[model samples]
Target: MRARLMIRYILGEMIPTFFMGVIVFILILLTFQALRLTDYILIHGVKVISVVEMMGFLSTSFLPILFPMSLLFAVVLTYGRLSADAEIVAFRSIGLGMPSIIAPALILSILIGILSLQTSFHIAPWGNRQFELLVTKLGSEKPATIVKEATFSEGFFDRVVYANKVNSKTGALEHVFVYDESTPDNPVTVIAREGRIIQEKTDLGNAASLRLSDGSIHRTSQGRHTKIDFSTYDVSLLDPAEQQFRSKTPPSLTIEELKARMKTKGLKKDERLSLEI
Candidate 1:
């Protein structure tokens, strides 16, 4: 009965500390991402709700790393406190050995280890993939969200966008310039008096269209230059989300998928070693 009580007491002390440690570690980790998240909200014009959802998904990926560290912190701090308070001596006097005193912590560690394994192998990968998909969707659906006033923005695939003035509320641009290098053989420079970003849905997916009024397209090919003037022109942007989805990394793969990839023939030595690790 005393052993059971001691075990319960030790667990009671450790569990709360474990949660506190996890919270502290999470906050520390989030501090690193806070700047990037702020840019997502302020510069990329992402919704607050979407940012919160991103944080939730990111937290899941942090769990596997946080769990073991928190458990260890809890065990160390709880034992230190118990030792300082003479609880260890008292338990020893009652015929409890060192193993009995440490058994609760060991059992908790085992349970936490099981949970860590589940998160590391399954949950974290799913969370990482979801986070990546969300980012890609955001970039694809509204490429102009990344365009900043008085700065050259290269988030658009194979193009650089610049605007002297931008209307945040309506995404209207003044004195816009774009350099399109999607066709390496024929580079084009577009200068527009006024423009706005338009999101269009096609059979392919969401596409960004830059609607320019009173603009001229300067194209150069084989040392020849040509200028085309238009009252209104629409420039369609290529969505990179499909390409991003195709390049899945190891962290985004489950253990079974990783194993399968490792077995695939003709993998480079480094790639196979990475998967094995």
Candidate 2:
């Protein structure tokens, strides 16, 4: 009798969380699948492994999307079902009012809110960081995740570099090919035995620059073509670092961080709420 009542109470409290967790988890998994493929559509493209890594990155990226949704769903389903089933009416007939039936639900909500706060502040942030690390490591490894296989792997900013074989180690790009598409009538194409991409912090932000050694370029000007050999050459291109940081997508912050930010935004005048038990 007493034990059964306790079980019913606990069930009433958990109904919302169960529904919310199932729905939220499925939706989040789907979103991660979609975000991971973003790189595949980009010009140079991304590798599948890298894209998978990005999915790992995105799970935390969706913090602002998931937690609240779960909480909201839970509250609505639990309360709506209770009302529809006339459980509230029965409780009220037993000398309990709306407030009494709602008391347990409210307590459950408070517990979820605290859990959500912790997730927002800590768990979400940690996931975001891991996601970033995965993206960074992947991008660095396969700088050109995809490039039509034989096409010139022109990085961002139209700066092109190519390789028959990427040594991968030592950042050396082999069987190198490069084309200056920005050139007006006379596009310069270069081929190198070995090359390297150097990343430097520029005035704008982080960008990739090229450092080619043992390279030769065929120059065409007004239909006249000349081939030149070079021991070394260096050119700067766009690195996503500055712009990429914005896209890296970090996780939700902790409660303390939120408090600090909200303070700047403006605090509420009404700092308290009334509750009935």
Candidate 3:
């Protein structure tokens, strides 16, 4: 019967894909988790607990990306295997047209797409919020939570920033380096005899600044150059946003919620209606 074949197709496409997705998700999560160790340990005083917590948090955030990828891989691999096995030929021999063969797969794809849309809108927003809160809590407890200077570093608000050397002894940012080569911002070298944290609360976002002192400022911008002999300066860390954050769970929400987002923009009524037709 048509119904049985459709059911078979849906199961064939989705199940193996789900397992592959989990494997890919774990691998990606571990890769990022490993990198966090260098910077986290540098600041948190290397500990087993820190590693476990970091891994846990990162994996929570990787689910959304994995779902769509898994669905794609599932459809491709399943159909490929069927074709190679001459299943398509068998179907054709029984009067199965292309549409007939694709019916179940298409239905399954639509279902997965609906799930993905929900994850991105509602579930992802909450997940991202938790991620930000976790990072904030960890950052307050361990300054190294925000310290990402293991390699050529880029800040949330900055394009280029680096730490030539971070003093493990005093928790001081020494040989501290930063280059905002983006033409609009200053191009400068910041040498902090020592740097420490100073937190400030703001209406728009949570803010923290690195207090850099005993440092001179060298700045160049937009066909102008200046050198300022200064005693102190502070670099601000911008606040995290709700929409930009993603959750760790591959959760689902309804289509009504998703359609409220910009992703649904193309689906809405247009001013140029009937013009193309």
lDDT of 3 by residue, 48-161 (tens): 675666565555456567777777777787778888999878888877788877776677778877877666566655555565555554454444335454456553344354
| Residue 150 error, candidate 2, Å | 14
The TM-score, computed over Cα atoms with residue i paired to residue i, of candidate 2 is 0.51
Which candidate, 1 or 2, would have the higher lDDT against the true structure? 1
lDDT per model vs. reference: 0.87, 0.60, 0.59
48-108 per-residue lDDT for model 1 (tens digits): 9999989988988999999999999999999999999999999999999999999999999
Q: Every model's Cα RMSD, please?
A: 5.8, 11.9, 8.4
Winner on TM-score between 1 and 2 is: 1
The residue ranges of model 2 lying beyond 4 angstroms of the native Cα positions read 1-19, 22-29, 32-35, 38-57, 146-209, 212-277
Best by TM-score: 1
Which residue segments of model 3 deviate by more than 4 Å? Answer: 5-13, 19-29, 37-65, 76-98, 120-137, 144-153, 156-165, 173-189, 192-211, 219-222, 232-277
TM-score of each: 0.71, 0.51, 0.56
Give the Cα error of residue 229 in candidate 1, in Å.
20
Question: CA lDDT of 107 in candidate 2?
Answer: 67
| Model 3 TM-score, 2 decimals | 0.56
Scanning candidate 3 in windows of ten residues, the lowest lDDT window is 268-277
Which of candidates 1 and 3 reaches a greater lDDT? 1
Candidate with top lDDT is 1
lDDT of 3 at 33: 60
Candidate 2 lDDT for residue 51: 66
